[model samples]
Target: MDLKETHISELLIAGNIDAVKTLTQQAVDDGCSAQDILEKALLPGMDIVGQRFKACDMFIPEVLRSAKAMHGAMSILRPLLIASGVPMVGALVIGTVQGDIHDIGKNLVAMLFEGAGFKVVDLGADVKPETFVQAILDHQASVVGLSALLTTTMPRMAEVIQAIKAAGLREKVRIMVGGAPVTADFAFQIGADGFAPNAASAIEKAKQLV
Candidate 1:
């Protein structure tokens, strides 16, 4: 990477949102393509952030700050990226299942998916099963991610799956489940396509699912 690109990545990892935004604008003004900025700078920085998070070297607050930095840079790049005809990796519809108001994990996964190039439609917490069905149809999403922080809400994940099947949309998308109370066995029992233990793995799982 060139010096400017390297600086962009460094600034992003450091959670310097203003610097990231300013340098990203400068890079674009200096003739850098939006794709180059995303691929070489923003994504690489987030890759390191993910690694640190997995290794316990970074905490949630730190990772969130980095995500904010990435968000700032993306604000400048997203329109240009769309205009440049760069295809998204896939579309993802994500939400916290009904009766589950916790969304920290879901939000983290959404940001990670965004960093990894998926177009994410976040339905927020307490999302109804029918909402998931509607969002899948509306977005033509390739992946559906459900999160539940409570064991009680875990069954809601199955309800959403059943609702998708009832709508005949089960085959149209891959379903992945996660959160503190979720397990691979639970995901299997619910007929979900995959389970992610955390936000970082969610990105990998989404990629594999698509």
Candidate 2:
């Protein structure tokens, strides 16, 4: 039987790891490009999962399982996706600001960006301003997301932004700030290009920026 697209999405949404693996391979075998599987199946499925989570219809366990399933499928699809030369939506360097170890939010944003077709270079938590600047320069990324869960570390967002500006990279990079204590006003005050309340919003904002 042909693998139905809906079935692939259902398997992903329900966190059916084995079923997703099998069906995804079948999709590849059927001549479906890996990018097609990612964009048409995995990404849409995760979008639903994210919506459910936002609506409180899905718990963290469910979301995590779905993410795991997506990850598994992507592992099989990466080489093909890479070979296809599908231009990425954009490139992003994301990190939790200095002095903050919180990464859950940052990781979520990274995943969302990846799903939305951005090439994400995640600079793990407690990243210094210079690191962000250097990564932006190295990757030639147009967007940078700074995450901070603590009030103390939130100030580092401004520092990072200043560093980017001082390095003459401000004109080229769109800086987005987020996390529990981060506010739109704060982001503006820090000269960030955007601010988001959550990962989903971050993706939306990044799209707008680029």
Candidate 3:
């Protein structure tokens, strides 16, 4: 990494939102492209945050702070990225399945996906199966993520998957499932393409699926 890019990465990991914003702007003023800043600094910083979170070296609060820093930089870069026709890694449609009002986990995963450079369309909690299908089709999303915190609600994930298949949209998108009661076995049984135990792993899984 360039020295300035390395500094930006460190600042991002440290959750220095203001510093990240300032340095990113400076980098732009110094003639660095938005894509270069994202690839070399912002994304690398979030990658470290993900690794640390997975290793238990960082907790939710810390990871959230890092995510905030990344968002700060993205606020500046998003329009530029659009203007430059820079494509996101992938687009994802995520929601907590119907009958499940729980959303903290889903929200965290959405944030992590955004930080990892994916365009995320969050449908919030208590989402219907048809809503997931519509969002996937509307966004032309590559992946669909389902979250269900209760065992009772877990079956809703299967319903969503079934709905996608019934609508002939299954082949167009990869389905990933997770939540407190979700397991890899359950995900497989439901015919989901991938499973994640937590938000960090969700980003990795989404990347692989895409």
Give the Cα lDDT of each candidate: 0.85, 0.83, 0.84
Clashing residue pairs for model 3: none
Looking at candidate 1, what is the lDDT of residue 191?
A: 99
Residue lDDT tens for model 1, 1-210: 273534888887788889999999988898888777876787778888878988999897888888888878877876676565434798999999999887656876776677677888999999999999999999999999999988899999999999999999999999999997799999999899999997778877777788
Is candidate 2 or 3 superior in TM-score?
2
Residue 182, candidate 1: C-alpha displacement in angstroms:
0.5
**Compared with the true structure, what per-residue lDDT tens digits does model 2 show for residues 55-152?**
99999788878877876786687666555543588899999988988675687678667767889899999899999999998999989999998888
Candidate 2 minimal-lDDT segment of 10 residues: 78-87
TM-score of every candidate relative to the true structure: 0.62, 0.62, 0.61
The 10 consecutive residues of candidate 3 with the worst lDDT sum are: 78-87
Q: Each model's RMSD to truth, in Å?
A: 5.9, 5.7, 6.6
